[model samples]
Target: MVRPSPTLRPLLLAGLLLPLLVGCRYTYLPLIPAPAEVALPTRVTSAALTREGGALVLRARVEGRFEPGYLSVAWFDSGRELGRDSVYLDAAQREATFRLEAPEAGAYRAVLAFGGNVLRQVELYEVEP
Candidate 1:
């Protein structure tokens, strides 16, 4: 049997373990980059309600390219929810319109929402012409 010197034993052990340690080093790469700040592709710029031919028409100015989603309006009178209406928007859409029954003469509020996110609130008043 042959015995290695103390210094040579450590060197032999290091030689055997060095390759394993080197192989164990991990190189990590992120699959996705960090998020960047960007504006939404579709947004409601303005909204209004008008009475036409005994009906209320909701017109919402949708600015930017329309993504396929639902643009909705929730009608409220005196802080009580009255009704809700929505229009399906596609890539070819540029504006949103919702026709609703004529509300009684009173002060009302209309909330415009897109993709379930509230975008704008409009105060409406209906009076006899």
Candidate 2:
């Protein structure tokens, strides 16, 4: 049987412990910008665009404190409007979601808006049937 030297023992111990000590650090920085600080139109909290199956879903949240808001999404292909859908949200409901389907397999753009403010999302969808 052979024993490691004193210096080699410390090195081996450190190598074994390094993995356990890796992810235990958290740095606090007060200068970071949060999503709340951004300018919001009509007090809308969040907007999301995602593709589900062959349909595109757009969602927006309008806080109850704000007035009634309209959430609308327009589908565009090749700079032309293919279709649009909208929903009205009242105080009782703070969120609105809309789903629209693409006509064919290709790239398409979705324009999401709440009243006068607009946001755009682009996605490439392929379908096989």
Candidate 3:
């Protein structure tokens, strides 16, 4: 059997405790932004939500000569842009999905835009305990 030396024991202990202490010190703020605007050029086939690896995933079905598309998930209410992530699609795709980070459990929307124009918007409700 091998045991860590006295000097090495402290470093190992500190490394393990550092993460625990850091985790407790951090604060998580959920997205509670103002209502977002809805302007659509055309409606896409469908937009829905599903759970993937414990994360909120927004999936959209789109088509046509979009060439370029944008996917975003945002929360809004009381007039503010709570939290949002907008990413450009590699290209126009029939099925696209974006994962929402630990957003505060609240009302949110997933929107797909093609060439700066929204193709679909779907409402989402995050159930929190």
Candidate 4:
């Protein structure tokens, strides 16, 4: 049987442990922001949330020329999802509105998403009766 010499054994052990120690350190690279030209087209120009009596209303103004698609507004309460509402967008439609029953008085957020990407979010706090 062949065996490593005493001097070679220490070198071999150091070689293996050196990589383990060095690899344990992680270096994260900073994210590069996307250029404005390559950014997603702004289909929704503005969105607002309002409470009307017993319902929450979402009014989003859309401005762009794109193929017909669906825009969705998902309601969340303290990180728990309540429900989602979607509206169809045609070429001629200039705005989208969604009305949903208001949840119990609490903090809520409405996320506006299009093409699987989030475009805007509106936070609303409903006062207790």
TM-score of 3: 0.47
- Which has the better lDDT: candidate 1, or candidate 4? 4
Q: For model 2, what is the error of residue 118's alpha carbon versus the real structure, in angstroms, after optimal superposition?
A: 2.8
lDDT (10s digit) by residue, model 4, range 44-68: 7888888888788889976665567
Positional deviation of residue 114's Cα in model 1 after best superposition, in angstroms: 0.9
TM-score of each: 0.59, 0.51, 0.47, 0.62
Model 1 vs. true fold: TM: 0.59
Tens digit of lDDT per residue, candidate 1, span 16-91? 9998899886567675768997766667787887777766778887776656888888987666787998888876
lDDT string, candidate 2, 1-111, tens digits: 999998799899989999888867765676685667554445556766677787777777665344676767787765678898888877687777878785456556677
lDDT tens per residue, model 3, 56-81: 67777664445565655564422345
- Candidate 4, superposed: residue stretches over 4 Å from native: 1-40, 127-129
Which candidate comes out best when scored by lDDT?
Answer: 4
Better of 2 and 4 by TM-score: 4
lDDT of each: 0.77, 0.68, 0.62, 0.81
Which has the better TM-score: candidate 1, or candidate 2? Answer: 1
The C-alpha local distance difference test score for the whole of candidate 3 amounts to: 0.62
Model 1 worst lDDT run, 10 consecutive residues:
120-129
TM value for model 4: 0.62
